[model samples]
Target chain A: MCIEHKKEDIMKLVPLGDRVVIKQLVAEETTKSGIVLPGQAKEKPQQAEVIAVGPGGVIDGKEVTMQVKPGDKIIYSKYAGTEVKLEDEEYIIVKQGDILAVIE
Target chain B: MCIEHKKEDIMKLVPLGDRVVIKQLVAEETTKSGIVLPGQAKEKPQQAEVIAVGPGGVIDGKEVTMQVKPGDKIIYSKYAGTEVKLEDEEYIIVKQGDILAVIE
Candidate 1:
């Protein structure tokens, strides 16, 4: 639970082999009906900002090509990806296939 | 379920790219503790005999080379693959990656 790490530490993370590191966007504070949800009541957003994309290469005997890039806004599959915490921030690392679509 | 389908009908199954058709081995009737397991009490075994292997090629933008061949005994991941029943027989269709190991 250390919040004292430098931002440089977070930037040092490099995902390998078609895995992309992403930062989940904060959940909407108000519902469509304008009801403000409590902190724990909010659903985890499936939308994320791509932070890093792995290099395209062969993995598990299958050739993979990374299709997304850093700074892209994407929607990912629910319940997919592993969560990683760094420098007081959290990120989800997932494969390119986990990203369902990119938002305009 | 019809029990009159010819064996040729089952042999005619051709697995598509990276998929394999396998027949599950019957669960052991007796445990090492010398207790007989009722039909409903037996656990589904993970081992299966491969009936067909997919032709390896580019699939989903990845190059794949199949490793297992027909008649090979293999262990597959639990909860993986789809079950198909025909003529009083059951088979599982799974990706080659789901086959964890081949028994010599």
Candidate 2:
């Protein structure tokens, strides 16, 4: 089940079945010492904001419910999700289990 | 909190918070047509068996409980967990969200 949410002009996508759609937080382009890093030199950020949530359902006969919702900021494994493009924007679709923590 | 379980002679490790300790499943050493593949040619398996689990607790004011427990076979993100060694054996520690599906 996909859940859609609107954030400004961005078309938010909702994930299904213990899945979450995340918009990655942008990394700083400049170093603390003021040197600007090239795009290729920067690693993908693990931090993201939860844009959509899936309704947790049963898997392998076990009932699972989502622990996160839209608008929650989260930290996830670096290579967790499948990258997708929507509305000319990049997003990630990750299982709930791939999320490491919810950032306060 | 960490929970320990023993399987055969293996010293199992329990994870903390939403963490899970997993033993990765071995991949096939040969192809379906009978060609043997070298160890380095094989990709790390994504499927694993749960050996230990941590008590789900509050994170960022949210009460989170674990949806998985010991003995559940699961599929997770390929690069999801941190690799660790114990008793000369390799294991992985992954947060619950890294798990994709529990295999029946």
Candidate 3:
């Protein structure tokens, strides 16, 4: 038998322009340099797990699809993304290009 | 006689696509519901003083100018903007449309 699912069970669908939705990696996990960051550190790096991506960037009035996909672990610039709170859970949505590099 | 100015004094010109640069108001100020947010508040409302604005939004392939300008104190969606640290000072850059409403 197949089970039915609610919309909440699926990631809410949001169409973005050359953008993607990222489920932010918990701030406490990732480390930088040779030392681990304490909880109270003022400048914690923002890392995220990709959830959804837009079709592609619009270049010269043409729509392009993205090279990245969901489930990629990415290292975005600290200054990237707009912080959003969805039902008390924080998420960030940003352009695909804003992602500096992928964590291998 | 007049004195010439440097680029630093000119707000580092950045031409954005319907975006704007905002000098975030010192988080220490601004109150909500008769209560002021303390420095330690986990969730501080991000209010900003507009320093620069883009020409306007791009609808289709046409460019449009912004309705607002520099020095406008506005309230933006908390989730809006990409943060940039310039000379150790934090500023947020976002599309003019991200500004939800102007504060009275």
- Number of the top-ranking candidate, with TM-score as the measure: 2
Better of 1 and 3 by lDDT: 1
For candidate 1, lDDT tens digit of each residue in A1-104? 34565654234445655678888877657779999774445676789999888675776666788889899999999987766544446677777889999998
Tens-digit lDDT track for model 2 on B1-104?
23555547654454546788788877658779998775545676688998777678853335778988889999999877876544445567787889999999
TM-score of each: 0.45, 0.47, 0.42
lDDT digits (tens) for residues B1-104 of candidate 1: 45565675354568999899999876546767998774435555566889999997887777777777899876666678999976666789999766655544
User: Which wins on DockQ, candidate 2 or candidate 3?
Assistant: 2
In model 2, pairs of residues that clash are A96-B97, A97-B96, A97-B97, A97-B98, A98-B97, A98-B98
Fraction of true A-B contacts recovered by candidate 2:
0.00
The stretch of ten residues in a row with the least summed lDDT in candidate 1 chain B is B38-47
The per-model lDDT (C-alpha) reads 0.75, 0.73, 0.65
Error of 3 at B21 (Å): 0.7
- Cα lDDT tens digits, model 3, A10-101, are 54647477888887665553555656655435666555688878776675575544655789776555666887855455578887656644
- Give, for candidate 2 chain B, the lowest lDDT window spanning 10 residues: B1-10
In the order shown, the candidates' Cα RMSDs to the true structure are 12.9, 13.3, 13.4
* All candidates: TM-score of chain A: 0.79, 0.75, 0.66
Q: What DockQ does candidate 2 score? A: 0.04
In candidate 2, stretches whose alpha carbon ends up further than 4 angstroms from where it belongs are: A1-10, A31-40, B1-17, B20-80, B83-104
